[model samples]
Target: MDIIERFLKYVSYETTSNEESETTPSSDKEIVLLKELVKEMKDLGLNAFYKGGFAYGDIKSDSNKSDTIFLMAHVDTSPDASGKDVKPRIVHFDGSPIKLNENRALDPKVFESMCYHLNHDLIVTDGTTLLGGDDKAGVAIILDTVEKILKRGNYPNIKVCFSPDEEIGRGTKGIDLEYIKKDTDKIYAYTVDGGEIMGFSYENFNAASAKVIAEGVSIHPSIGKNKLINAMEVIAEFHDHLPKCRPENTEGREGFIHLVGMKGLVERAEYVYILRSFEKDELESFKNAFLESKNIINKKYNKDLITVEIRDSYKNMKEVIDKHPYTVDIVHEVYKEMNIPCVDWPIRGGTDGATLSHMGLPCPNLGTGGDNFHGVYEYLDIDEMKTMVQIITKIMDKLE
Candidate 1:
C-alpha cells in the first residue's frame, strides 16, 4: 500500500495506550489494530506474528542469514489526548498555513516548526483530537519500506516489531527481549519514534522517578497553629529548592527536575517527580540536589517527616552507541545520500532504544516527520514520509 493510504488506514484504529494499567499491552484495544497489521503483512507475503497479544512481526529476505536488522514502531497513542474517532484531513500547502477545523489555522506563530512542511501535503486533524501520527506515521513508513524491499527482492533479512503502550512509557515492559534474541541473529535495531524528516538521535536522557513523602501531624484547626505540622508547606519548600533555570523553560539537552504530580493533606502528603538528563553527572547532580532539599526539609520540619524514594527508570544510550559507531554512521550516511539535512540531538525524553541499546542491542531513534505529538495539532508531512521510505531502501542497498 502507498504510504498515505497505509497511514490513513493505520490512523483509523484507536490504539491509544493506557498508562495506569499494569497490563503489557496497556489497553487490549490496541490489539485490534495489531491484528489488522498482522493480516496486512501476511497479505503482503511476509511472515508475521502477534505474540503475547503484542504486535510483533519478523520479516526475512529471500536468503537466510546469520545477521538481521530490526525496525520498530509503537502502536498506541497517548492517553493524554482523545484518540477516539480521530478525523484526519489532508491538505496540500503552498506556503499558506493550514487551517484546522472551524477554519482554525494551524498557526505557525505557535508551532514554528510546522512551517518546515510548507510545500508538502500534510495530514492533520480538525483540532478536536490527535492525528495519531506520533507513531502511526512511523508504522506506515516502515511497512511501506519493507514492502518495497520485499518487492525488489535484493534486500537482506529484516525484523519488524510493533510495540504497544509506548506513549505510556511501558512499551517494553511486557515485551520479552528474548523474542528478538531467539528470533534473529541481528544485534542492532532502530526505532522509528522521532520527529523531523532526516532526524537521527542516539542520546537520550538518563531518567529516574522520585516520590517525596511527608508525614504531617494533624491537629484541631483551632489548635493547629504552631503545634500542627503542615505537610503541604514542607512539600512546597521541597519544590522551591529546585532551581528555576533547571526546568523545562531551558530547552535543548538541558537537564530538568520536573514535578509530575503532588497531593497533600494535614495527615500526610506526597509529591512525585521525574528527574532527567543526558549526562550521568547531571543526573547525579539533580539527584543530589533533591536529596539535599529533602535533608533541609527534614531538619527544618520534623527530621522524620520527609522521606525520599528515587528509582532509576532508564539510562542514556550514548555509552552503548559509542561501542557501535557503525549504527550512527548508517543513519548519517542515509541522510547525506538522500540530500536531507541530518540533525543530531539528545532526547529530553526516553525511548525504547535507550533500554534496548543497553540490552545488548545497539538501537537508535529515527524521525517520523510528525509534530505536536500527543495533542490535537499532531500532523505529518507527506513528502517527508515518502523520503523516509527511500532512506530505508537506501539503507538496504548499502547493506548489499
Candidate 2:
C-alpha cells in the first residue's frame, strides 16, 4: 500500500483520546482504528491480536533472524482539539499558496516560515479539525515498511506494536513484555514518534501530575466577610503564590508548573497540573517546591484552604538510553549512511519510548516529518515521510 494512502485512511478514523476517561483506551472511538490495524496486520500475513478489546494491537514480525526488532507507534490522537471529521488537503505545489478557503489559505504567512514547502507536495488539514498526523504518519510508515519487508523477505525478526490512548499519556501502561520472547536480547527498538524533519530523539521529560483541592465554608455573599472563607478565593490565592518563573513564563528545556485543568467554586475547587523536566533532580525539586508552597498556604490560611496531591507519572529515559548507547548509535549510523542529517534532540514531552526504555527496552524516537501536530494547522512532508519509510527499510537492513 502507498504510505500516504495508508496515512489518510488511518486519520479518517476518529481516535481522539480523552484524558478524563477511566477506560483502557480513554475513548471508545480509538477502538475503531485499533481494530482496523489488527485486521490490516493479519491481512499482511503477520501474527496479530487485539488485546483488551481493541485497546492495543500486538503483531510479531515474521523474520528468520534471532535478534528481534520492534517498531512502535500510537493510535490515539490528541484530546486537546477535535480529531473528528478531519478533511485533509493534498497540494501539488503550483508555486502559490494552497487555498484552504477564501478566508484561510494554507500559506506560509499565516503558518509562518512555511515557504520551504512552496516547491514540494504536502498533506494538510482543513481549517476545522486536527489532521491527526502526529502518530498516524508514524503508523503508516511502520505498516508500509512491514508490508515491504514481508514481500521482500530475508529480514531480521520484527515486532510491531500499535498502542492506544497515547495522546492522553497512558499508551504503554499495559504492554506485556513476556510476549516478545527475546526480552533484553531484543537488540534495539525505535519509536517513529517525534515531530518535524530534524528527526532524532533519545531524551524525554521526567513527568508528574498534581491535584489541589481547596475547601471552604459556604455563606451568603453579604455575611461571607469574616464568617466564611471562599474556596475559590483560596485557590486563587494559591495560584498567586506559585512562582512566577513557572509555566506562565517559560519554554523549551526549562521545566515549569503547568495549570492544565481547574474547576468548582465557593465550597471547593480542584486544580490539575503537570510538572515536567529533563532532569530527575530538577523535576523532584520542582515537586518539592510545590509541596512547600502548599504547606505555606495551608498554614497561612489557617482554614485548610489547600490539600495538594502529587504523583510521579514517568521518568526521563536518558539513564537507560545512555547505558545502551549503541541503541541510539546504530540509528545515527544508519541515518548518516542514508545521508539524512541526524541530530539528537530533547523531547519536551513524553513518548511511549520513554516508558519502554525504563521497562527494559532502550527505545528512542525518530521523526515521520510531521509538523504542527494535534491542531488544524497540522501537516506532513509527503516526500519526507516517503524518505522516512525508505530510511526505516535501510535501518532494518543494517540491523541484519
> Cα lDDT of all candidates, in order?
0.83, 0.80
lDDT of 2: 0.80
- lDDT string, candidate 1, 79-159, tens digits: 889998988988887776678967577877778997788878888898998999989998999999988888878777777
TM-scores of all models? 0.93, 0.86
Candidate 1 TM-score over all chains jointly? 0.93
Q: What is the lDDT of candidate 1?
A: 0.83
Candidate 1: worst 10 consecutive residues by lDDT?
179-188
Off by over 4 Å in 2: 18-21, 26-29, 53-64, 93-96, 113-118, 181-184, 214-235, 263-270, 298-305
Candidate with maximal TM-score: 1
lDDT of 2 by residue, 150-253 (tens): 89886777788888888877888677666654433556688897665566998988999989999988999887787788888788878777766566688778
| Model 2 vs. true fold: TM | 0.86
